[model samples]
Target: MNFPDLQTERLILNQLNEQDTSALFAIFSDKKVIQYYDIDAYQTESQAQQLIEFFNKRYLENLGIRWAIRLKENGQLIGTCGFNSLNEKMKHAGIGYELAANQWGYGYASEAISKIIELAFSSVSPFCELYRIQGDTMIGNEASEAVLKKLGFKEEGVRRSSGFWKGEFHDLKCFGLIKPEFKAL
Candidate 1:
């Protein structure tokens, strides 16, 4: 299947290719950007390339999809957002995203995410059957939490020691947006 490309008023959500390696690395390599992320800050361009390959592999296998978030005006890749895990039979998916630290506070994350949510809940989307989309944020990641809340995800409480990364387990705040809730937005 063709990779789906989505758009918002000021951003474009499209496939991540080799050409995006540098930009992708730049985002993931920033310590501030990955402070709340599960993975450590990328130290090499190969790490970023591997991530791109992993995302594409997930899409090819129908397990998930991640879009490169780019600026419409300059086509500069700023970050990525998409379902981290997708189970069509269960009608549920887990979402993930990250943005360049410099790009924070501009509502780009929210705008890009809103578009993804719309498609996930739309009848014409490949993800149309998805009934639930969830996100998990490390404790203290207020910025991410606010974005999720702004997009209509309800706080579903914290999962103690539910995530293990960066050499230790960390608590994760769960947020969920069901199709009904999304449609109501």
Candidate 2:
């Protein structure tokens, strides 16, 4: 499937490219931006390059897609978001997203997520069809939880020591939204 660019009133979601490497690194390497994320703050632009490549490869393989979020007015990259791993046969996929610290509390994350949810649930291709969208964040990440709740996801439970990253285990709170729930939103 080809990657599709999405737009909202204040933001645009497009494929990550070399031009975005620096801005992408800036967000990922910031302490506040990745505070609750499992991975360590990126230490080099090479990591961002690898990440861009990874995102594109995921799309080429029909596994998932990640869109770089930018402001509509100034065209500045603000964050990244999209479905992570996808299970086409099961009609489910995991959602992941992050934004720059300076861009917090402005509803950009929620807006971008809502748009992606609508597209994901509405797309009907064999590979793009998704019945359920799941988001798992570090336990105690209230900001992420709020975003999920605002978008109509229901908290299922916390998986104890579910995520192993950066040499330690972390609890993950799971949130899920089905097609019907998204439609109601």
Candidate 3:
């Protein structure tokens, strides 16, 4: 299947390719960007390359989709946002995203994520089967939590010690939005 490219007023969400390796590395390598991210900050370009490949592989396998968020004006890759896990039969998916530290507070994450939520819940989109989209933020990541809340995801509860990374288990704030709850902006 062809990768679906999505667009917003200020951004473009498209496939990650080898040409994006350096930019991807730049985003993932920043300590600030990955502080709440599942993985550690990237130490090499190869890690970024591998992540790009993993994203493509997920798309091909129909497990999920991740888009490189690019600015429309200068075509700079600023971040990524999409379903990290998709379950068609179960009609649910888990969404994930991150941005370059310099790009924070610009509402780019919200803009890109809004588009993804629209497509995921749209009857005509490839991800139409998805009835629910969930986002989990590490407990202290207020920025991410705010983004999710602004998009209509209600806080389900805290998942205590549910996530393990950075050498210890961490609490995750669970948020979820079902089709009925999403009001497109």
lDDT accuracy of residue 5 in candidate 3? 94
How well does candidate 3 score on lDDT at residue 135? 93
Summed backbone clashes in each candidate are 0, 0, 0
Show the lowest summed lDDT stretch of 10 residues, model 1.
120-129
Between candidates 2 and 3, which one is better according to TM-score?
3
- 112-173: candidate 2 lDDT, tens digit per residue: 99988888887553356899999998987899999999999999999999999878899999
Q: Which regions of candidate 1 fall more than 4 Å away from where they truly are?
A: none
lDDT of 1 by residue, 46-128 (tens): 99999999999999998999999999999999999999999888999999999998899999999999998888888888753
Question: What lDDT score goes with residue 150 in model 1?
Answer: 98
Q: TM-score for every candidate vs. truth?
A: 0.98, 0.96, 0.97
Tens-place lDDT per residue, model 3, 1-185, is 67889889999999999999999999999999999987888999999999999999999999999999999999999999999999988899999999999999999999999998898888767753888899999988999999999999999999999999888999999999999889553
Off by over 4 Å in 2: 123-127
Clashing pairs in 1: none
Candidate 3 accuracy as lDDT: 0.92
Q: Model 3: runs farther than 4 Å from truth?
A: none
When summed lDDT is taken over every stretch of 10 residues in candidate 2, the lowest stretch is 119-128
Model 3 pairs in collision: none
